[model samples]
Target: MPATLNQLGLPAVIVVGAIFIVWFVAGNELMRRRGRSLAIWSKRALDPLGGRQAIQWITLHSFRLEIEGLKPPFTSGNMTGLVESWDVPITWLINRLNGRRDMVLVQLALRQQPIRGIELFRPRSLLAGDARQLAVQEGWTTEPFEEFQLAAMPGATPQRLATELLAAIGPRRADLLRLALRRRGLHLTLALNIPNRQAVQPAELTGLLQGVAAVALRYATPAEATD
Candidate 1:
């Protein structure tokens, strides 16, 4: 019996080893798809299986990933954006299974901030009406209209700006995105959500967001906003 048990263990170990290697390699590939820069913070912890999980987070947007390690401020120059990535495998898996999505949120510095009133233009899927985001959800009202709904708080929706928004959305990509304008920055969300992170295209997302930002700039407050 002892000899038979030992014989079975050898084959079982080989099969388990192969499975582990595949999982590790696939996980690494998914983590590295964006070509992240050297991590400002790398901490080692336990993985789901209670094994070693080594992960790093590159906080600053000052330097590019092409360069090795950290570069001084003189060489790195001005920072364009801040990015934070989560490499928790369990959290990623849970979000996929639960139908939750988290895409990159970009907050680019604006030359001028928007006013108190906010205009929310949403795709047809959502209620196309006006409501102040700061106000209580129940207190809000929606007067559904057009291809894209224009909702505003504090006053009537600006038809001129709404027209511009409609033009910005255009015919081709109108259905795929939603735009929300606040006093300081614009928030753009993708209506299409995929289960896997690797399926997301960073370049496409960045381009769409930049286009939206450009359109919003026309309405920017002429003077710098006071804090």
Candidate 2:
């Protein structure tokens, strides 16, 4: 009976190893597919704004998108976007445990500095500390606006700016976690809660871009905002 049990243990180990190998391969393949689909969806969604010149996959569930030569309405400069998804089972589990979810980040570096430095973000955000540090360094005042905290230099009119920006974002304001107008550019991070295998819509992306563009235009230096 002891000899028989030892012989069965070796077979059981082999079966378990095989199952793990299959799962690893299948899981990765699925993640890859989801990533590629996301890239396509993003490109299509951004078509009205500009053409996507490049896309690089950082991981099976993460990708970076580059849109060169942004069309009118968006100031000439660089627009970089990245999408991070939790499709892999292990990663999804880890992210869940950490109380984190999928997110999309977009950074637009304008050729001109249109607006004064300001940062607005929700409380307890990942970059809340950074905003605080920026406020202290620039001697900016910090205030609260609804569920978001606003930091801006004197005479920057934090209230007005927050109102305009939030209005531009519309109902989707809930998804917006951060919107900062830096010295030379804008940074936006939106919390994504996409269910199933669906992708974000074109109009949704368009709205966000238009909102940012509107802010940039409103504060443009006139001469510097041309073309």
Candidate 3:
């Protein structure tokens, strides 16, 4: 009886050990696969918007603008002006990533400059006609506007272009802009929740965000000063 029990025990131990090894290996591979998937998805999504190059530009030149109330004695300049400034940075990033630096020059001419306007209604004032119109125009159906303000800066420079870029990208990517601009620094954070939840993968989200940033920079410019 003793001999028989020993034989059974040895096989059982071996089997358990083998199972553990397999599980560990599989788990590690799964993690690696997930990471790679995320990256691929991100790149594919951002391809049209200009890829890594755009992201780099935003990382280097992006700045945070703070606003108070609806008035525009902006501590620096007009919000629109600030958007304009971002143009070169945005274009540089996108074009570089897309490997289309040559296209950047041509795109520059087509880009629109920032236009200063008064905020007729606060974002929170959904009841206001202007706010509602903005919402409709931007295709914002569910989210409420957090702030509503306007600026009337009159100039054409990098700053103005940056401001215009921000405005153009704001409606579609308000959440991203908010996160990127939440702090006063060059590094920006991107929320990968949407793509992640969809099981789209980390790489994919990164690529997509990078692309969007590039496009935003490419088309953004300050309104030509009417002075």
Best-to-worst order by lDDT is 2, 1, 3
Q: Rank the candidates by TM-score, best first.
A: 2, 1, 3
Candidate 2: residue 117 Cα off by (Å): 2.4
Question: Which TM-score value belongs to model 1?
Answer: 0.39
Tens digits of per-residue lDDT, candidate 1, 53-156, equal 33333532222222112211101111121222234456556645533443222223334454433344443322223233432353434444464455564344
lDDT of 2 by residue, 128-177 (tens): 68778877887788888788898887664667877887787776675666
Model 3 residue runs over 4 Å out of place are 1-7, 51-180, 193-227
Work out candidate 2's RMSD over C-alphas: 4.7
What's the residue-level lDDT of 183 in candidate 2? 65
Q: Per-residue lDDT of 1-227 in model 3, one digit per residue for the tens?
A: 99999999999999988876776566455544544443334334433433122221222222222222211111111111011111343553563453221100001111232222211222332124543454355443423223423221233432343354345444334222222211122222233123132543334443444443453334345534666
Cα-based lDDT for every prediction: 0.39, 0.63, 0.32
Residue 179 deviation, candidate 1, in Å?
3.9
Positional deviation of 39 in candidate 1, in angstroms? 12
Q: List the residue pairs that clash in candidate 2.
A: none
